[model samples]
Target: MPKEIAGPEVTPGARETQLGEWRIVALKDASFALDGGAMFGVVPRVMWERLTKVNSDHTVPLATTPYLLDNGTYRVLIEPGMGLRWGEKQTAMFHISHDEGHELVTSLRAAGVEPEEITHCLMSHCHWDHIGAACGADGLPVFPKAQHWCPQSERDAALHPDHLRRASYRKEDLQPIIEANLLQTFEGETEILPGLKMVELGGHSDGISLVILETAEGKAAFWADIVPTSNHVHLPFIMAYDMNAALSWEVRTKWIPLAAEEGWLNLLYHDLDQPMGRFVVDAKKRYTFAAI
Candidate 1:
């Protein structure tokens, strides 16, 4: 939404797709902006600016997306976008926009899936953008019936935030879930539910984890911040936003090649263009993205 910046328009409602034995709905939430410099990390702007557009303020628009994995039994929602609770100042800072196609709640309703129908809300971490929507304007669980799943390490980090985290881990965003005592946390690689598993890959955050699922074609991974967007499909494109650029690089090196080799279903949450794709290795072993 937020006016596609030279990308195909995604339908407002959810579309059904098959991933082996699983049903997937790649949900759109909102379009927000971030500093282009931070997004590109050490990459020189002279190079990256050519690859993507930037606003007058040097901020780039990013997609806030969540993925729904349903196997008829479990309704799992991953990466619920920034909640609809931002004030004018915060909105201005983040440049959050609400195009009909990207409004989180409306998109969910339009998809014919009500909030109460979500059985599990698996969070990649407690980063404001990732966990903000677990609760809503009323400060109650938006998906009232869903159990909020996250990494215990992330919850602990959010609870005892340091200077580096103070800005990223917003207390107001997470208070409701904590007050409701609904948080269900896992340690490392955990199968929080049937057919759904997650493993911590600390790059974006201290406890940032990627969600994995069983797809019809092969294994699917939601590598969270490891590969936030399609642009990052290029191996060297790390973001300055990552807490551990080294760790992110290390993880990308390990997981990306496997994703390409094994034909894993890859989900890019922050990619404004396409959300689902597979990694392909060219004759020279260069990675490229092929949308599903």
Candidate 2:
């Protein structure tokens, strides 16, 4: 049984902040929902329920938050989008919806960027929710001129997911990008740009990675599904859908504290209301988030 509760409030738009030489913006895309129980993993419903509202079907709303990293010379787009590939059945099932202005291309245009202007497209993983907009309806790459990057393991997983994981991936999403000769796959920690790097942390999926950017001004980490929402700042809040729960715990244990102590700007991918924030450890030695 699900209890009636209010959904997280969302501020819809292009949220921007400047980190050193780069202008980082969280571009809105299709919003959807996921099973609350699966989202909270081992955490009890009574414990996680208070942090977020639940739909009648026990699903919690999630935001598809992709980021745009723009330095004067190069424009990097991370976690492309939830995309527009969902059919009416899937859309209704997931409660997916986005206004015209919230479309990836529209959001990019609103941020004063054109699709072709994107120099690099990075996907933390190839899960359909994360790389849905890799192509368009015409089966063409959306960022036609950009060099797309993904973890080699994730690329393989997306292309050939096992029986239990097949539902989370779609081959069509990556086929066009592959055929275009624009997709670049990496094995481990690789510096994609001067100050930007991808650190592969396998947990939620085999090849999910963390995108980190550091410059003279400050540092920021794009926490793919590792820490999808601010509510997941705690170390044990791993998602049940993760392929490797123990690995997720190990990764979160190491990174969450580092982000807090260093005061890095933590960019969340699925938090609907609070998209970006800083992890803070209080006097009580408990983790809390200071939303940005």
Candidate 3:
């Protein structure tokens, strides 16, 4: 059994929803503020600022949200929010600010789970925010009993990074996990569990993946960074941080239409307002993120 850790009080809308065979719970952790221009990619600030409140510095607040998938037998955690390992300089650089007691581990505790109780830590990519909470300050896997899964391509990139965007992969995040022998890497669509599988949707990162599973209603998909926020459900709303902008747009246009048609409870990673919602196609054939 794992030791209990207290989490910050749950805010409104932080509850569980039943999806066929599984139950999904949305949990919020830390937040980081980033420039709106960078977040909106090619989209003009004038347009995005209108949709979201933009600060004088042209920055927008992003929520680092995680999800807990409970099927009564297993508990799988997707993308534990940015860990609380930043020093003064890093804190200032990333504009990292967390709620009172809502760090990743604490958020899990808030959900009545301990770190060791997590059976799977499915990472979408090796981005710091996505993998930070996997390791502790002393460089050890936080979820000692869980099977930590990472894409082989992402592991290679993080270990041997190139010049561009190298800072995004933090050593503290990967080194500890590797040392603990809890890390498992895979290629293509892999079935970590019977109903849960990771689909390669590489646009944001070379090896980023989207975790999808069958639900009683339809299907639930964690599209990862391809659609970080519900607002990014729009075809062109991609982040400039994507390594391949063309691929991002291509993938989004292709799969999102299918998602809307089939009705997926999309769990977003960075949407401050809405965490998970369904998509509906209007008469214009445009996919809109409908709050459920």
lDDT of 3 at 176: 78
| lDDT scores of the candidates, listed in order | 0.79, 0.86, 0.80
Q: Model 3, which residues run further than 4 Å from truth?
A: 1-15
By summed lDDT, which 10 consecutive residues of candidate 1 come out lowest?
1-10
**Comparing candidate 1 with candidate 3, which one achieves the higher lDDT?**
3
- On a 0 to 100 scale, what is the lDDT of residue 208 in model 1? 93
Model 3, CA-based lDDT: 0.80
Residues 1-292 of candidate 2: C-alpha lDDT, one tens digit per residue: 0122111212333277777888888898888999999999989999999999899999999999889999999999999888887789999999999874668888889999999899999999999999988797676899999999999999999888899789999999998899999999999888999989999999999989999998886678999999999888877889999999999989988998887777787789999867777777766667766663
Q: Write the per-residue lDDT of candidate 3 for residues 156-248, one digit (tens) a residue.
A: 888888987597798778887788888899999899998789988788889899898875456788887888876788788889999999999
Candidate 1 lDDT for residue 138: 83
**lDDT value, candidate 1, whole model:** 0.79
Q: Which stretches of candidate 1 lie over 4 Å from their true place?
A: 1-16
- Greater TM-score among 1 and 2 belongs to 2
